[model samples]
Target: MSKNPDTATQSSSGVPPLNPADQKRRDAASTLGNASQSKSSPEGVKEGGELPKGWEWKTIPDLVTDDGVFIDGDWVESKDQDPNGDVRLIQLADVGDGVYRNRSDRFMTKAKAHALHCTLLKDGDVLIARMPDPLGRACIFPGDKRLSVTVVDVAIVRSGNGEFDHRWLACFVNAHPFRSAISGLQAGSTRKRISRGNLATIPLPVPPLPEQRRIVAEIEKQFTRLEAGVAALQRVQANLKRYRAAVLKAACEGRLVPTEAELPRRSGVPPLGSAKKRQDAASTFETGEALLARILTERRQNWLARRSHGEGGKARGQYKEPAAPDTTNLPTIPNGWTWANGEQLFSWSSGAGLTQQDIQEGNYPVYGGNGVTGYHNAFVAEIPTLIIGRVGALCGNVYLTDGPAWITDNAIYAIQTPSCVAMRFIRLAFTRAELNKRAAGSGQPFVNQRMLNETVIPLPPLAEQTRIVAEVERRLSVVEELESVVSANLQRATRLRNSILQKAFTGGLR
Candidate 1:
């Protein structure tokens, strides 16, 4: 995007513009050097956000004492052939400090270099790309010896000095207003570009001598801290995401629970046990009946709660908890176990419906098909509950609640019988379970209370259920740690990357 202007002469070939007030300060600063400051102090802060009295404010051009401007070089295209040349080539990769540092994987020959004489590199020279998204990004030449490469889509700004600091000037070019103005001038199709001539037009806020060094230091220090924090947050987010996935994986694997109890040592599947064993276990288990009774009682209460408090929804169906013993559905039961539907373990209720007036910006999390969408004043389920999305994008998505919630009409609540099942266990099961898939519908899937209540799930003993939940949590912790370590490393790498940029930008290194 460099303007193809031939500037082998030492004239200000374009604008004849210069601010007189700035010219006066430049003249004044040249005479005083850096002696104007507070007594018995290293330096003083700018007065009322002002630079020290004698400190001059100048554009980039005035700082350089070179006879000719940066445009005093030829502009040419790069080589088309790969070379076995002895000099390292500098590309956009090397033009980072607004100068070339020779980062190309290959070098160019003296013949190739002379053929493509875009711009020549000199000590204290600045190079800025005038193309793509990195337009206006300038780098300073910390000249030693490096290979010269094809200068494709790049502009070089040079100075011969005992004059300006390369590090200080690079930072100034990268600072706010200058970079912004350059980017704003970019115009093209498919690829964006700003002419090198346009880059020369970029305005800069050049504070004199000691002040430039101070501002660069301050900006570097603040940016270093910010880069560190951004790195840490990214690491934490990665760790948390991995941890959550681990938790789910362990829950499904069933390793989280303690497997302290030994199973019966059997050779092959044992022949059918005596019927009397089943009868005895059934008769002795009061829990089987009591848990079921409580669920039915709660289901009735939930129905009443819905009728009283819920916004009048569709009169779909009113389903009671399933009757306790259905021997037809089960041929056998485990010791002290019973076969039952989900209806006997929870109270099902549809979420509330409210017009815009009834809704208020409030504290309660409102559950809908899209998860929590608003703070609601009124509520749906009053206990620890499981909510399933009943419509729209997140249909079949399930969420577990810790307490009372205000939910939208597109979800249904399943409040577990207080003593029967652990709420967390049920929520985990729902996450893995296929509930909506069983519901029959075409356009929008619907799990009416009847279908939901009657859904059958394997009912392990209550004590076993608690054990399973504990095991899931225990196993999840290890997976969580693994994820945390990966995340932390990612964060560290990010911080190091930014540190490289900061060091290079702030004169910490070449």
Candidate 2:
């Protein structure tokens, strides 16, 4: 038996093409019938499986109109652009995942655009990027006021008939299932990409026109709420950072806790220059100036002792005392507090170099510019100390070690803390000093021993240093707790966004 001519011309899928009016009625009927039959279908619909009733799986080419077009963009190098060009060039950066971001500023003359035969973008045209961050991510091109062309590797899809909503299609492309399918088909070992042919072959879930509109509306409504919550969370994060800086600023300015000048009689300590008279006094509170004097005396004694013991026999020259800090530009401190250079409070030493080959899995943490980089069996500084990042971008960062550690050459360690000084208080002071401002190198910023020793710090009285450290810690602890909560909520918001997209695609939202 021979087939009829009409039947022979029809597509093998057995569905004849319908006019716009007839297609609309058929789609509505199919959607209503499916909704009634599949009310209890599984929510999770796997790709290549039976779709929810009324939803049909269509390839990219199947969804397009008879006159629809698909093409890749032009290949224009940076040197090809004319200074006074009429047509704007749209790069991948101009397209966000499911959103249009007009960041492309490159342009070429209209004559060139016509010669290149670029696909001129129009309103509601779907653009898909071939490369990753996320391969196959797509967005709808919003119409431009002027003529525009996209770069190569970007796929452009245009429908002659207004059969599909661009926003709905964009959302589907950005959702998880479509991305997963495209990811499997991506090529390249380093920078992965999906060819235009592969992209056209990927299956698309086609819901009825009315259902697509509903899904898009609900998704936008939920996204609006999610974005507001994310904005508020970000603001709280920024405020927390400012608050931390304020706490450190207050601590270093001697305003965090009461000073001996404000409460001299609280500990029965005599004022400065009366140490001889108060020798019998059992008070431990000492003015910062008094403590500085004692530290300098001890340093001289230790140097002399080393010299006599021949520990410095190899020295070539006499030691020159560091010049006193020029504190004329420094802020005025409290009465019992004094301004002193870091050299007078702690002995600074550069760390030794230890390569990756030298490091081994062991008990000691090998410190670097940022933090612990590796482990080693050897120890350099045995006592608790402050580590200052000395090289690269992390220069001037400060960290207090809990115990023995091996500090790498990329950092400088404060080895000896004077008897009257609190290490924690000095660390806090450094945090407020913004020492990175003094970094030297133009290419890679650096802090050397000289810069560390010459840095001026506001020295508080011994009793007040302890109190300030305690108060700063107490306040910061609260900030840390609040930050933890904020971070958790931010993570939750991301999960919720993903969940909404999943439900919207799976018919769960309906």
Candidate 3:
């Protein structure tokens, strides 16, 4: 919401009063030179840069018409808003760098607009966001199909057919150099902002009227091409996401590599037509059920060992077996593949909590529900361990530690995974399952050891698990490399944008 400006400046004729600091910065620029040129730097006029022959340095107030308005928007509180009213309430979100975002949908009645004295917006008026995230990003206001007024945090500039171009001013404000200068003037410890008073003081680069049009056009032409390239790169990223999903689906489905059952047939084993032939082939390979049994046995022994050492907290009187998955309506798996509940594959436990003070510069990485929340001196889980996000929005997210790590209370880790299983295979399986969708609560969703213990997933033979992990890694590695290239080019595009702006203002556009 915004606060109304003084009644005297409500119409275009009056200029808003400047604060002492604003007045000082404003006076400093003019006192430095009049009609004198300096070399232009990426940081703009503040850096003492030279301008072209016809160009001159001017403050925001010097560029606008005597009748033009430069003021902050009215402070309309949420309580004053009416959703069905006729006047639209523009917000900081609606101001984009050199573009109109039109992201807010707030409105108030025409009567309310008059009562609050909110400045009504026009088509070509420039709106500047005063808050940081690169403060002082300005954009032309494209009218809401209805009447509109912006929030107090946004400064409105109405040139009212002045000697200068509003579009040029918006472009100048968005330039890298201008934003860099504005950043230093921003205040507020919690959320940085540039006051309307301070905003009025920044020195602006003004070119001859005709040159301004040419510079704006050339910048847009290059930007249009850059945007198209970025769009293409984004499409490739989207397709790669689809491709990654396909690879995971195929790997889990026994299609990515030869099945353990089929591999034997390829290696001179008898074809499986008769039951006797199938039995002979099956006996040669270890089945998923057999592998799971070995894992469960190892987990039981570890628990017993911990209990004997008085380490396993709140030990039960008796040892309980891992639960079997309910596979009633599940899809059929290839021969040698079996379904196992989560607990049958690995032992799950909550991680120890580590405070921010305890997390320090160390060799061990500290992990929370999200990966690598910080670094710590001690590790709670060894390298190659499977971790699952246990709480909040990230609950059910899975990650595999590359090195010894400290798992925080916000996540759970596999306390014991049999050496026979491939951790990579488990990570891929959990990812494909989209475990977050099964998380429990609407707010602060969580997955306890009990919840994970009961979740069912398909399991392949130990040998097949190794093959799947290797193949998936190979394909994903290629995707990762291409992603790196795309990422680099995206960064390159940003540099090019800034380069164009720097040239446009410094007379390098020609």
* Candidate number that wins on TM-score, 2 or 3: 3
lDDT per residue (tens digit) for residues 1-510 in model 3: 222233334223232443456544444334323322453432323343656787876666666665677878889999889999999999888898788987888999999899998889999898989985558899999776898998988888887656777788889889876676666567789999887755655566688888888888888888899999999999999998899999999988889999888877677663332122125535466678777777787878877887888875645467888768889988888887888878787778899988787787898988899888888778988757889999989788899998799999999998778777888888999888788888888868988888788777778987799999999999999999999999999999999898888778777888
Model 1 quality (TM-score): 0.42
Lowest summed lDDT window (length 10), candidate 3: 270-279
Higher-TM-score candidate of 1 and 3: 3
| Order of candidate numbers by TM-score, starting with the best | 3, 2, 1
Which residue segments of model 1 deviate by more than 4 Å? 1-52, 67-83, 95-106, 118-124, 141-145, 217-510
Q: Report lDDT per candidate.
A: 0.55, 0.76, 0.78
- Candidate 1, residues 1-510, lDDT tens digits: the string is 222233232236332232345443233223222222322111111113333344444434444445534543333334533557655556667766433555667566666666765354666566667665466677776664764533556655544542556667776666543555555556688888765544443433344466556655665676677668766767767677666666654553444443212122222222223232222332232243344455566667766677767636532367444565445744443443345565676657778786546778876788886688777776766776788888754576778877778877888887445555666776666665566576557776677677666665444445555777776677667656776776677667556644544343323432
Cα lDDT, model 1, residue 380: 65
TM-score of each: 0.42, 0.78, 0.86
List the candidate numbers ranked by lDDT, top first: 3, 2, 1
Best by TM-score: 3
Q: Deviation in angstroms for 437 in model 3?
A: 3.7
